[model samples]
Target: MAIPRPGGGATQVLDRSARTPGRRETESALALAERMPRLILESRRVSSTLAHGIHGRRRAGPGESFWQFRPFVAGEAAARIDWRRSARDDRLYVREREWEATHNIWFWIDRSASMGFSSHLAQGPKVERALVLGFALADALVEGGERTGLLGLTRATASRRIVETMAQALVADDKGQDDDAPPPATPGRFDEAVLISDFLSPPEAVKASVDRLAGRGTRGHLVMIVDPVEETFPFSGQAVLHDLESKLSLNVGDAGAWGEAYRVRIAAHRDRLAEIARTQGWTLTIHRTDRPASEAALRLLTLVAAARGTG
Candidate 1:
């Protein structure tokens, strides 16, 4: 797309030197490899710490319907022993209860160019926060016995090794791309979606994507990642802003003067986004990079719990 230069001079052409097929795939994989270790360690540390505060789903009740049986160990209560099942084996067995149902929650982490935005005022890039938060959520969800998967990358599963699963998906060429929009296909009915991104795309595109998922009967929770610099507009005097995706630059004179107008526009955009999500019966949340990631993770988990009727 051609972007008009600031002050309505001449239109500027974007640099597409690396737009060839597999170019991004290769670069992204290498970058992920270099950063995977740090990401994993940080996510594990955060998730472990959060575990002490967040509560898991309640266990099945004593009178709950039986699902299976396991051999009873020493110190077991006699009243809990399954006599019928024990008769089949020499060892005594205990009845195990099943959950009411299983719900699959899929996570979509945006790897778009804009997600790499970082400023002196922020802790890290938007993508870093998304990965860490996504990992932590997967860690908690799997611990709670919920099926979790990376949307468009793998099938949903209730595996304790979710961190590894996500790492593999992140490095996979076919699964991890900075696509501008999600794949056209929709998720299954009753499935839940967790979309982590900056949501900097055009309003219509964002609306269409959410509408597609909602039409497919998938309830969703959106986590919109924003850098502190983007939200606060801390520039002064003259400044240059660049669009990461289109590679277009806009020069501003007295950028400090433009802060209010910029903030107003962003606020309106967010309000519109929230309205769209509400219309589709989904939830939208904003997370700033400068804040603690645990906060975002907890808020997201609460939303998911409420949606599943477990809260």
Candidate 2:
């Protein structure tokens, strides 16, 4: 939703035609290409805050490290049987190697019209925070010997210059990042994902988008980016609010009267989002633009680790 300027103290009053021009969602990736260096620096800075580095997943699959020994099953390859371990027990056993999605961490950041929103109480636009957090997590994942990429947009890579690689991929795509939801991307079964977005879409639409990610058994995390003004409706009196997505303007008479109802509705919306995440066996995190990006990054690292049974 469009933000109205504070008028007469805590109250806000706006003309029906008032429009606060913002960085449009249709902004091209070419512009972002120029900001790559700065954004990269910000991503690196946020990622460096965590002292504990990620390394491997706790699952069993193709890997160099030993994971566990399980009882050998019939029809299994005899070469897989660990003879020495089997001698200690009545049943034959096989050593399983640790499987890591070291090269399968995927990211998707929403760049819709609603995400371009920035209120006076925030550090920058919601889109900016999403980009920063996405890159920051990718940088950290790369540092941990993992590959990261934009879901349905770029291939996963463990490149040291994560921001540059992702930026170049976006530049080539050229299409406007107008989707409020993640693309219909399927991650590897053992893959982990982080979706950065404002997630203001209706719960049904968001659920459909999320299903695309979870369909392939991808362990997903939803990071909901919000503005402080949106979290706390600090406005009162007559005002006009515009819909960033629909671009429709509405006259909000006595904005003060709607404050409680607005908060309740938003709370219900979040509950629905959380429930959808739970049903899909995913996690949800809320990040405010007013806070440090590193906070969300750290939480996500923990979530990914826990999902992989490392934490």
Candidate 3:
């Protein structure tokens, strides 16, 4: 199945049909890399949908702090012309300000095994949604003059080259070396972080990861990507459940009988994550694959703007 065009309804799904032998049914990392162009385009398309929702940063250009005065060029805004400076010079003069650039905003995408699961009830794999959301947010962030990079794979940068760099990293990230834990190095105090993941790891593990960043004075945003089936647990009758990362298997007598308990556990897990965010003074937003990627991307940008005191 092909990825649905932007604005397509919830039923639209990402194609995961191609796979190498011995690999899971989900789209392999190589297949995903081959489709990077399409993914980036789709991400930009989704971002454009929400672009109108965000206002341009008022102080995005040169800093408001005064620097020097230069002769005003023709057709310049009258307000930009400094009357005091012009009075002392034969030509019109304009006040210039010191340039103030924003700090790097790091994005961490979870490539854990569970993130690759796409239930028949949902749109696509959690990882796909996360990548789209990350790229969409990166587009907006870069457009807004903020530098961005993947947390573990790349450093913060404002160069447009980082986009392709990130895509390459995402496609090559299927080696399974990294777990759901946070990156080892903490971000600088001035830098901001955005973490997108299914966050299916143990609650303690998740807390430890976030706490490590928090300890370093890093204020981050936690974006939880969820599959519709994961949240609803809609399976019924007898079914075998398998762990994506660990190959552990379980025989369920009746999935329906386990739904309520499963939901409760999931809800508790979410609550713990929320509490962790609160304790760290960070923000948390949950995005489901069944929903529009733009929704999450927009919210993530808003959080980024707010964190950087730009919005």
Candidate 4:
């Protein structure tokens, strides 16, 4: 199926062919920024599950709702030491409880060349959709007083003050290049992680990265943004296809002969991803680039709501 173009004057679809003439594509960063507040609000309405899960007002501070107890450390506050428990065990123990202040949300975006694919009928490319979604999510969580951080799989920083900085850096016109690499180890503990990608890489690689994030006890939400062309594998007649990340090319003279095989492969890929998400208890949502950003945002919100047990 083809992606539907965005209607109204809210978004402008850039012409990719124009990039070959040495003219720079006008930056839409400002336009995207301006739409962010509205998107965030809309996201909240759609994603009551996530909004309620993360933003629900809980009792202030480390209270008696059992997180864990640890051996008392030197210079620790005496008030935190559980005297009643200490008397029973004859060993000093400090009550460690879940605190609202420690909750942090980390957002990751994929900036690989594969993410630039967008059908003529679609509103924008995968990368652009991912950026807008990440921005809106971050803005919403931050607005709710949660500490938020941003990371491009190709770039990462953990500063609370620069939540949208990485996304802003990705505003350049699509060059169809794949120079960006995965980020180095990230600093600080993250409570939840949101990953936006096309996931063009092998399933094992994707699963490994996800496992690393999960190892940190971080709940994960993986948003797979794809172009209609990629999902449908629509290559009519003869065509030359290229792997954007590997820089490898394939020429096919008979599109009809390979259509069935291609569909099978795509189905297997999606099934594997779904199995991984199920096993890991992670939320996975797929958005087509041809869909309106508003539609994609609503779907994402629904996923979040489901995660929070609100759906």
Candidate 5:
């Protein structure tokens, strides 16, 4: 995808020899070997920080477990009224059954080139935190008796070896690694989706991807991973802005002055992202790379539970 010339910045094709693929790859085999072990270890550690078994997988529907007994509302449906429970009370009551069923949650973490970005202020690049949070979420969900998998790439699995399985799926993929978003696919009804990305791509494209994945009554979530520099636009004079996805560089003169307008455009972009999620009845959690992964993990867990509860 071509970079939008924000603020009319002058961009040109970068010379191939200056920073070739050999020099630019963040997923170069050596780096993946170093990051994978930590990805697995940190995922388990982060999952351990959150309380387990909270998801009772409960929703109000047809099930064996009794959810609650509520005062029956006047809707003329006497069949739903519990005559036995009503016998003890002046008001008629209705028996509400909790939906007790295992669920499938699929995750998609952006592995595009831009996700490799970082700055001095960030703890690490965006992908590091993305992978950690993704794996951690999968671990937590599996513990809750829900199946989890990599969206569009792997089948849903509740295996005890979830981390290893997820890691292997990513390791085996040698194509479309540079694509900005998850490829479109259809998941089962009542399935949930978790998408982790920087979301720097065009909003229209992102919206389309969300629309497709959320089809068939599937609910989704958006985890926007950001770096400190992207948040603050801390560039100065005589700077070169490189499009990590496209490998095109822009000579935006006086970047310090460009910060204000840049910030405005970015803010608008983020607003669009939030709007997309809101319209779809989905949730959005913004996770900065510098913050604790546990914080986002906990927030996301709560969201998944809330979605099931209210769904």
Candidate 6:
């Protein structure tokens, strides 16, 4: 699953770092999730305020809006029994309600070596950012009364008991790392599939996985967390580049001469990603390692809101 680089080779890895016990990483992620309700509420309020002049109908709620009709089940609430429909069909049926413009948001993060890059001196690694964002998004979705879960390139779990399992997997030693871990198996009719990755994998592989999810009725949203160094090619003079995943090394001399070419290649890769996302009608956001999690969270929420509008 190597991505073809502009040079006569391919990019097998991006971030390379030893597995270290992340200090307060779990606590930080939990805290961020805890703050998600307030953040989402504020975002909604801000959006409403900003669009005050626009005339639009109020959105329907889960209780008020009728989604569909289902066969009446034993012990079901009598209030849910649709008498009118029963009179017409002469069959017992319950009225199915719809929730308020909400959808189940499943956060899938990539915890591969490429996600361990960090440019900010004081900031956590890209993997940490992915974890925090996933946690926060899941928390927000849950607060909205939408079912939420998390999945990673190396781990996937749905139970609240395993909510932090993905993060733990990231910090675990990869002495016997399994590269064949399958993509997260999603249930039928997923509302949204949010992927946080550097996308170091091949474009075809990534696209195929996304298409599979979309085929299952999951709307895809890709959040690409890239290191600033990777984006800018800031290395100077002669340098030895290492492949984080494969442990391969390349020596590059005269960084100045290669800087422009590297930047062009990176830009092309990004453009290709953007084009793919656009064609799939998926929200694609690029986050830098230097940006604050709060800023990234707001941007992610904006994407979610935009996707909701399209829905």
For 1-311, candidate 6 gives per-residue lDDT tens digits of 12224322233222235232221332343333444444444434433333322222236643358678777655334665789888887688766555422345666666565454454432555666666666655544433334455543332222332334444444453421223122657644637788887776666666777777887777878888776666766656765555545546556677677777878877777787777687777878887767665566667666766665666
Model 3 agreement with the true structure over 1-311: per-residue lDDT tens digits: 11111111111122224223213544363257676898788887887787665534447545456677777654334676789878985898767554313357788887665666676666877777888888888777766656678877776654555567789887777653346665786677667788887777766777888888888778889998887776777767765555555544456678787767777877887888899899988988999889999888878777766765642
Clashes of 5: 0
Q: For candidate 5, lDDT tens digit of each residue in 1-311? A: 11223322112223334555322544442255567988899989998887663466633355447777878754324666799999996989877554423357889988777677666677877778999999988888767756688877887765557888888888777664666778776778788999998887778888888888776788999999887667777656655655655555666668788777878887888888899999888888898888999999989988998887766
Q: Which candidate leads in TM-score?
A: 5
Return the TM-score for each candidate structure: 0.78, 0.79, 0.77, 0.63, 0.79, 0.65
Q: What lDDT score goes with residue 252 in model 4? A: 61
In candidate 1, what residue range of length 10 has the lowest lDDT sum?
Answer: 1-10
Put the candidates in lDDT order, highest first: 5, 2, 1, 3, 6, 4
Q: Report how far off residue 74 is in candidate 6 (Å).
A: 24
What is the alpha-carbon lDDT of model 1 when measured against the actual structure? 0.71
Q: Which stretches of candidate 2 lie over 4 Å from their true place?
A: 1-31, 53-103
| Candidate 2 local lDDT, 1-311, one digit each (tens) | 33422110011224555454232432432256676677778887888886475535534445547778877755344776899999996999877554532338888877666666666788877777888899888887767656688888887765576777776776565454656667777788768888887777777888887787778778788999888887878878877666655555567777887777777877888898899899988999999998999999889988877776632
- Candidate 1, residues 1-311, lDDT tens digits: the string is 11111121111122333343222432452366678788888888878867754545555553245577766655334665789889987989866555423357888888866666566677876778889999998888767656688877877765567888888877774445558566665577778899897787777888999999989888998898887766767667765554555555666677788777777777887888899899999999999988999999989888887876732
lDDT of 6 at 274: 76
| lDDT (C-alpha, whole model) for all candidates | 0.71, 0.71, 0.68, 0.54, 0.73, 0.55
Candidate 4 or 2, higher lDDT: 2
Cα miss at 21, model 3 (Å)? 12
Q: After superposition, how far is residue 39 of candidate 6 from its true place, in Å?
A: 18
* Residue pairs whose backbone atoms clash in candidate 2: none
Better of 4 and 6 by lDDT: 6
